[model samples]
Target: MDRQAPRAGFTDVDRESDPRFYIRCLDAQHASAFKQRYKRRTFDLLELRPGQRVLDVGCGTGQDALALAAAVAPDGRVVGLDFSRTMIDEARGRSRGKALPVAFVRGDVHHLAFADDAFDRCRADRTFQHLPEPRQALAEMVRVTAPGGIVLIVEPDHESRLFDSPYPDVSRRFFAFRNSSLRQPGVAHQLYALFKEFGLTEVAVEPLTEIATEYASIAHVAQFEGGMRIAQRYGVVTEEEADAWLAHLAEADRTGRFFHAFTYFITTGRKPA
Candidate 1:
C-alpha cells in the first residue's frame, strides 16, 4: 500500500480527547498487551553494554528506559524523553529511589535538546509512525549519538500481515484499517533509504514475524472493535465503516479460524567514526 501524505505531528488531543467510553473501550482492547509485545521487541533490538550512555526517544512510560539502564549497569545512564508530561510523570514515579540513574525529561523528538555526540546509543520504537517529519527526528538522533554509535529503529508493517481465518475478507480489512491510521505510508519499506539519506552507514534491516493464534476468539474481536470505535471518534476513519469492518472480523473469529501474523522492521545503523 502507498504511504499516506504526511500530516501534522501527533497531539495530546488525539490521544486524550476521546469520549470517556471510547477511552475505556480502547483500554479493554489490548493496549496493555500491545505494549508488552513492544517492550520485548525494544529490549531485543537494543543491544546495550555496561557503561554505555543511551537515549530513548519517545520513551513512553519508560519501561524500555529502565531495562536499558539495567543492561548498562554500574556507570551508565539512560535518558528518557517524551512530549507528554503525564507519561514522564508516571515514569519518574516508577523510578523514584531506584538508584538506577534513569532520568525522564519532557521533550520533542524532532528537536532534541542535547549536545552533539552525547549518547553512545539511541533508540526509537513505534514512535516514528506518528511523527510528521520522521527524518528530522532521525537526524537529531544521529547528531546526538557518539561516532560509531548505533541507532536502532523499530516499527510495525501494518500493510503486511499473514492471517489464517475462515473468512479471508476479515484479514484483508484488518490490514487496510491499520494502514489508514499511519501518518506516512510504507514506513517499513523506506527505512533503508532513510538511513542512507541521513549518512548512517553499515545499515541492516531485520524483519520480525509474529504468530499469535489467540486472536481468533470472540473476546479478542470485541476488544479490537472497541479500539476501532475510538479511532473513528478521533477522525481516523468513518464510524460506519469501522463498525461494519469489525463485525465482519468478529464473525470470522467466532468460527475459530483466527490467526494473524505481521512483520516488524528492526533497522540498525551506525554513525561513522
Candidate 2:
C-alpha cells in the first residue's frame, strides 16, 4: 500500500473543514457510556492525590481536567492544554462559574510550556493518534512529570478497525484510507515499545476493544459517514461503493449481526522514584 499524505482529522481543529462538527463529535464521545468507563479508569490509574499538580494534554473541552481538579482538590491544580483556541475557548466556557482548581491553556504538545518535573502526574487520552510527532510528544509528557509520577495515555490503533463485510476489498480499501487519514493512527500499537525505549519504569499496557452492534453507536464517535465522504472524495472508494457498504452495515444491524470495532491501548509508566 502506498502512503498518502495525511489528511487526518483532529491534527489542527482550526483547519478542519468543519471544526464545530469536530467539537460536537467530541461532546458526543464524552457522553458515551463506553468512553465514560475508560475516562473513569484513567483517573483511577493515576492514583491522584490531593494537592498534587496534574496536566491533561489535548484536554478537549476540559472535561477530564475538571474532573481531575476535583480529585486533586484544596491546593492542587489541573491545567488543561490544547492547541486550538476554539477548544480552549469552549473549555474555558465549560469551566466557568466553577471554583475547581483547573485552568485551560492553549499550547502545543511537542513543546510543553512547563518546566521539567512540573507535574505530579500527566495524562493524554485519545490524543496521540492526531500527533505528527508522537515520540516527541510522549517525551514531553515524560519530561514534565515529577520523579515517581505516572504518565498515562490512551490511543486507538486505526489499523485494527474491523468491519464484517462480504466484500473484503471494500472493507480493506475503505479502512486503509481511513487509517491513512490520521497523523499517527498506528500510535497505539507502538506505545508499549516507546514506553520502554523512553525509559519509563514500571511500564504496563492494557487493551480495550470498543465494539458496537448498532451502526449509529459506533458511527457517533468514529464519524464514519464523514470518513466515507472523505474516502469518496479522495478516490479511495467510490460513492456508490460507500453507499453499498453503509447499506450492508444497516442490513446487518437489522439482522442483529452488525459488528464494528477497533482496539485501543491504555498505557502507563512511571518516572523513577
Per-residue CA lDDT of model 2 for 1-273, tens digit only, reads 343635756889978778878788889888888888888888999999899999999998888999999999989999999998888999999999989999999999999989999999999999899998999999999999999999999987888888888867988887887777678878888999999998999999888888888887876666667777777777888888989987887789899998888777899999987
The reply for model 2, stretches above 4 Å from the true place, is 1-6, 223-226, 238-244
Model 1 reaches what TM-score against the true structure? 0.77
Residue pairs with backbone atoms closer than 3 Å in model 1 (clashes): 3-185, 4-185
Give me the candidate number with maximum TM-score: 2
Error of 1 at 106 (Å): 0.5
Q: Give per-model TM-scores.
A: 0.77, 0.93
Off by over 4 Å in 1: 1-15, 18-45, 164-174, 216-223, 226-248
lDDT tens readout by residue for model 1, 118-234: 999999876787777888989999999999899998876766766564445544654465555567546776888999999998999987766565553324422466656655655
Tell me how far candidate 2 lies from the true structure as C-alpha RMSD in angstroms. Answer: 2.1
